[model samples]
Target: MHAPDRPASYAHPARLILILSLAPTVGLGIGRFAYALVLPDMRDTLAWSYSAAGFMNTINAAGYLAGALFASRMIRRFGLAASVRWGTLACVLSLALCAITGNFYVLSFARLLAGVGAAAGFVGGGALAATIAQSRPERANFLLSLFYAGPGIGILASGLAAPFVLQGFGPGSWWIVWWAMTALAVVMTIPVLLAPFHARAALTETTAVKFAVAPVVIYLTGYFLFGAGYIAYMTFMIAYIRDAGGGAAAQSAFWSLIGVSAFATPWVWRRVLALDRGGLATTIILGVNAIGAAMPIFGHSVWLLATSALVFGVAFFAVVGSTTAFVRFNYPPQAWPTAIAAMTISFGIGQTLGPIVVGAITDALGSLSFALNVSAAMLALGAVLSAFQRKVRSF
Candidate 1:
């Protein structure tokens, strides 16, 4: 008799993706975006100026860039699972520190540390997911999508939980949110611990692929601007809502909608991602996101905010995915790592500049709405740049 076939669950890669995804969920969802939820309270309780608040995210973005630079080396040294495990641990510790301190400098340091940890976890988790995709080539896209969707799960959970906490514990206890996030991070770390790790052979040959900025300059520029524009909106959104007289209930609904929309992004954009028109895919998505980012400034109706959240949520993560797709279509497999790294570094630089600049604008104008309009203008310019890109051809 033939040996019994492996059970579907045993053979399927979903469980592995599920486990790996927790890294992004915590790293991005709580470590990064949760600041938006916590910011209003932090401002009121801590008596922080808008510029000071913006500087916190600016330092965090700088840390994220610094961490990204070192993440590849860490993955090589510690291996993927260990890197992810330790990174998650560091992130939780950072969150815990944020809870314990009310000092401005100390809290800024904590956000910066959290950014570093989040970047490490994000990089390691993505590499692990790529390894799994190689092993299960047929389901590669779906599995990767599931892994990327982890942030959406984190966002959803935070959006749902934060309002309740704020309502129950009151706004003065913003530190409670950080502690709660730390607890969730502890739970999320379990899957990373349980996931199996296998060593792979080292790459023996280096392929010489010449990278030229002129050929894809427009696309790269567009992506960089996208990094700059999207972050400003995300960093200040909660405070903006509160300024507009929105209550916790409205905030919960708006943020949760974004999370829910994010969960459905892979399916929505699968066809668009297949496009190989140099920067067309990215151009379209960025345009949509820019509209979402600008909507609140146009009007403050409940329907407008909800629509903005849904559209913004749907396109936010997928914008990064578009750049990955661009690299895949334009470069050989061996060149992917270098191209992606270059693009990521550019994106990180843009993010580092975005928050502080927006903050300065807000401080000058005394209007978050004006800052958001500036963000939308940047995104629009990015779309224009992306529109000029053509598929790279042999010289």
Candidate 2:
């Protein structure tokens, strides 16, 4: 087994992982998900059609795809810790950019930049987290979940505040919300910068392992569907809440619930994430995630919508953790970055297409409900495809 890479500031692996988690907090939670919280406002203030709003996220996903394609090179050139830090820095700077202007082109560029940084940060952070987990194999599942769940803190903080900022400042105050998110992102990024990975990780990067794709194509395909499916739910669900007569308080509660449930993900799926089966862990979580996405389809009841938020939150992040566990189970440490990047690229492509497609449907139908249905169906299909994949040995 490889030696630990935890910084000297924290002797405990879990604690180090927790600090490292701040990368995703800024990269994903603030950079990626916060866009959803601000989307409705942007659409209203910018006078964007659903398609235009969706384009913003699509461009961001495009950035994510680009970043994923190059993540291995970034990791190779700069190492894990540097990639994570630089990525978070990009995200923080981008968030500040979101506040400086209402120009759609500028905002789109910010979203695109955020996606690029987020992909790098998320990919690097996941790989580094996997490395730390390697040092404590028995507790690997728990540790990995903690790292993946880092976005929940970003979600929770932003969820709790972004909605109120939008409501309190009222209407065009969306830019103010972005400033608040920027401040929060700055705070969250501090811990990630302070934590440097142990130098031993450089040993594993010497010869890059080829991306694992052919043998696990089915599993990868399922994950691609997952990427496609989940973003629709996240990107447009806030609109649904508003459509359902949910105001600022409702949005705050709903988004915050997701963040809360997201934080609880490690405990909720620890045992499932430990499974060695190629897609069994992914299947279970994706199934749960499908259920969550579908719950909002039945009616406009507050209980119904909130239930969807909770179920979706708990399972969504776990699906990401499951993919990491899949790589750890089937690939050697040297291949982790390449393999993770491959999975990310697949996921990224799916997400890249999702928002625009789903948004088009909403625009065409004049409702987000049908789009939600399509999102649920995609996830269900992903679960089915994943079920066909069984365990395989690491090379």
Which prediction has the highest TM-score against the true structure? 2
What is the C-alpha RMSD, rounded to one decimal, of candidate 1?
4.6
How well is each residue in 257-352 modelled by candidate 1, as lDDT tens digits? 988987787788877776879889888888898899989987889999999999988888778777766765676544444455567667777888
Model 1, position 115, has a per-residue lDDT of 78
Model 2 clash pairs?
A: none
Clash totals for all candidate models: 0, 0
Q: Which pairs clash in model 1? A: none
Residue lDDT tens for model 2, 1-395 = 34344434335889889998898889888899998998998889889999998888899999999999999998998888888889999999999999999998999899999999999998988988898887777898899999999888888888899988888888888899989999999988888888757776655652487665678899989999998999999999998898778898999888888889988899989999988877999999999999999999999888998899999999998999999999888777788889889989989999999999999999999999999999999999999999998776655
For each candidate, the alpha-carbon lDDT, in order, equals: 0.77, 0.88
